[model samples]
Each structure stands twice: as structure tokens, then as C-alpha cells.
Target: MSGERSGDRTERASDLMQLNAMALEETELSLHEDADGRGDPAAAERLHRLADSMTDTARDIADRARNLADPVPERERR
Candidate 1:
């Protein structure tokens, strides 16, 4: 981490965020397919809950990664 720039970390985290968004979109499509096309409300509801949990986890991951990537004070680096 010594020589790494904050910009690089920010970009990686941003990419992760984008990927998370794509995952959510895919989940939505699947939910629609199950709920609307197949009329399986139970399965659709499960998928919906999974997507919600994933969203929270993804945000936490992105935030943590960004925070870790930032340069720490000299004393804190140890």
C-alpha cells in the first residue's frame, strides 16, 4: 500500500460498485421472469430478499475497500 495511489483504489472500488449494480439488474430480470411469467410469488419473493441483502453487502464492501485504500497516517500504517 505504500506506493499505491488513492486514485487506483477509487477506480477499483468504483468498478466493484458497477458490477454490483449489474448484478442487481440481473436479479430484477430473474425476479420478473419468476413472478410475472411463471406466477411463482414465493420464489420471486425469495429472490427479492436476496437482492436486497446483496445490495447492502455490496455497499459495505465498496465503502470498506475505499477506506482501506486511502493512505493512513505514518503512525497508523504500522
Candidate 2:
């Protein structure tokens, strides 16, 4: 039903948010490791890039979820 579909969407959004948080944590750890000289500079750079990319993706997912949860006015739809 419609309610079930909405619940599913909400769950998916929650998952995305969790993933975003995890990615951020990973990025932070990578940065810390690099700072401590325990991580490779090149690998740290790659992790930073990946983190940025994931952050952007997460933002897009959040935006989509928000839009889905609260649709725009009919005039704004098209």
C-alpha cells in the first residue's frame, strides 16, 4: 500500500544517512592516520577523494529523499 511504500522510502533514506556518516568517519580516520605518518600520503589523498565523492552522493540522496517525502507544488513540478 501507499503507507508501506512510504515506510520503505524512509528506511532507504535512513540507510543512506548511515552510510554517509560511516564514510565521513572513515575519511576522518584516514586523515588522522596521514597526520600521524601511519598512512601513505597517496592513499590518504585517494581516501579524501573517495570521501568527498561519497559526501556528494549522500547529499544527493538526502535531497531526493526530502523531495520524495515532501513534494513540490504542482506549478513547480514541471
Q: For each candidate, what is the lDDT? A: 0.66, 0.65
Stretches of candidate 1 exceeding 4 Å from the true structure: 1-38, 71-78
Candidate 2: misplaced stretches above 4 Å?
Answer: 1-38
Model 1: per-residue Cα lDDT over 1-78, one tens digit each: 677788876767667776775676677566555555545678767776766676676667666655655656899978
TM-score of each: 0.48, 0.54
Cα-lDDT of candidate 2:
0.65
Question: Root-mean-square deviation of each candidate, in angstroms?
Answer: 5.0, 4.2
Tell me which residue pairs clash in candidate 1.
none
**Highest TM-score against the true fold, candidate:** 2
- Which clashing pairs does model 2 show? none
- Model 2 has a clash total of 0
In terms of TM-score, how similar is model 2 to the real structure?
0.54
